[model samples]
Every structure is written in structure tokens, then in C-alpha cells.
Target: MFYDVFVFLVIILTLLILSGLVSASEVSLFSLPSETLERFSKSKIRTHKLIAKILEHPQRLLITILISNNFINVGIALLSTLSALRLSYAININPEYAVSISIIVVTVLVLLF
Candidate 1:
């Protein structure tokens, strides 16, 4: 039981980090200057070409990021809820109250970092 909870917490943390990275990447991509994008488009590097392709349709990229970020956030919320449930069970606390507390704490943590 302890090990399961530990693993779940680790997964939740990993999801949070991935969510942050995706959010940051979206901002970084949108903030790139047109000149930089043009230069990247002309480059022979495979990664540069991929980035250029993604940037060609900024709206599509934005939509994709938003969708992915939503999924990640949901995953984080679900995992945290489960963690709270497990903790509350172990401590003989009410699961209903734990749910609200978990969501608030997770939201604050995500926003803080």
C-alpha cells in the first residue's frame, strides 16, 4: 500500500513537470520572431524543419497545446485525488473533505511553480 501511494505521487509529480514544460514551450514558440522562424525554415536540420512546420499554423499549434495541457492537468488532478483518498483511508479521515483539500492544494502547487 505504501509503495503504491509512493508510485502514484511520483507519477503525479512527473505529470506536473510535463505540464509545465508544455505550457512553457507553447509560450516560447509563440514568442519567436518571424525572422527567427524564417531562418529556421531555411535550415537543413530535421528538428528545425519540424519546428517550422509546427509554427506555420500557429492556431493549430495553440489548439494542440491547449488540448494537451488540459489532459495533463486532468491527469494531475485525478492522481492527486486518488492520493488523498488513500491517505485519508490510512488515517481514518473523511474522503469527502480530503477531495476538496487535495484539489485546492494541488491547484495552488501547480500555480506556484
Candidate 2:
């Protein structure tokens, strides 16, 4: 009942955070100039070196990011719909209004994140 809705909300929030991080990483990774990438390549840090190596093929990186974001977005939509349905059933309200509320809340969360 209420517990299921709460679980959905929690999952939705987590996905929103993940979506934001994925979006940020895409921007940050692509915005790096060649010089910075070169520096990273030469750095002693393994993580930096790996980043430089991965950035060599921009197409693959971009595709992976887009795919992940798309999946997260889909998950968010599915969960939102489920939670909205549960909420409507629990409160005995019109499903349309519950759906509208879910849409608004999801939009705001996406924008904020």
C-alpha cells in the first residue's frame, strides 16, 4: 500500500540523482581540451590515465553516456507512473490528477537535479 509508494519515491529520487551525475559527467568529459587530455594521459594517476584513454574515442563515450541517461529516464518515468497509480488507488482520487501530479513532480526534480 503506502509502503510501495514510498519505495517507488525513493527509487525515483535515486534515479534523478544518477541522471544528474551522468549528465554532468558527459559535459565535463567532452568539454576537456586536447591539452588537458594529454596532461591526464601523462599523469601518474591510473584513473586520469584511464580517462585520457577512454576520451580518445569520443563517439563511444558519448554513446555510452546517452544510453545510460536514456535508461535512467525511462526508469524514472516507469516508477513515476507506478507510484502515481498507487497514490490514486490509495486515496480514491481520479487517476488523471494523480498522473498530473507525478508529471509535475518529476519535471521539477529533473530540472533541479
**Top TM-score: which candidate number?**
2
Cα-based TM-score, every candidate: 0.92, 0.93
What tens digits encode model 2's per-residue C-alpha lDDT throughout 1-113?
Answer: 99999999899889999999999999999999989999999999999999999999999999999999989988998999999999899999999999998889887877776
Each model's backbone clash number: 0, 0
- Kindly give the stretch of ten consecutive residues in candidate 2 with the minimal lDDT sum: 104-113
Worst 10-residue stretch by lDDT in candidate 1?
Answer: 104-113
The true-structure Cα RMSD of candidate 2 reads 1.1
Runs with alpha carbons beyond 4 Å of true place in candidate 1: none
Model 2, runs deviating above 4 Å: none
Candidate 1 structure quality by residue, lDDT tens digits, 1-113: 66777998999989989988998998899999999899999999999889999999999999999999889889889889988999889888999999999999999977854
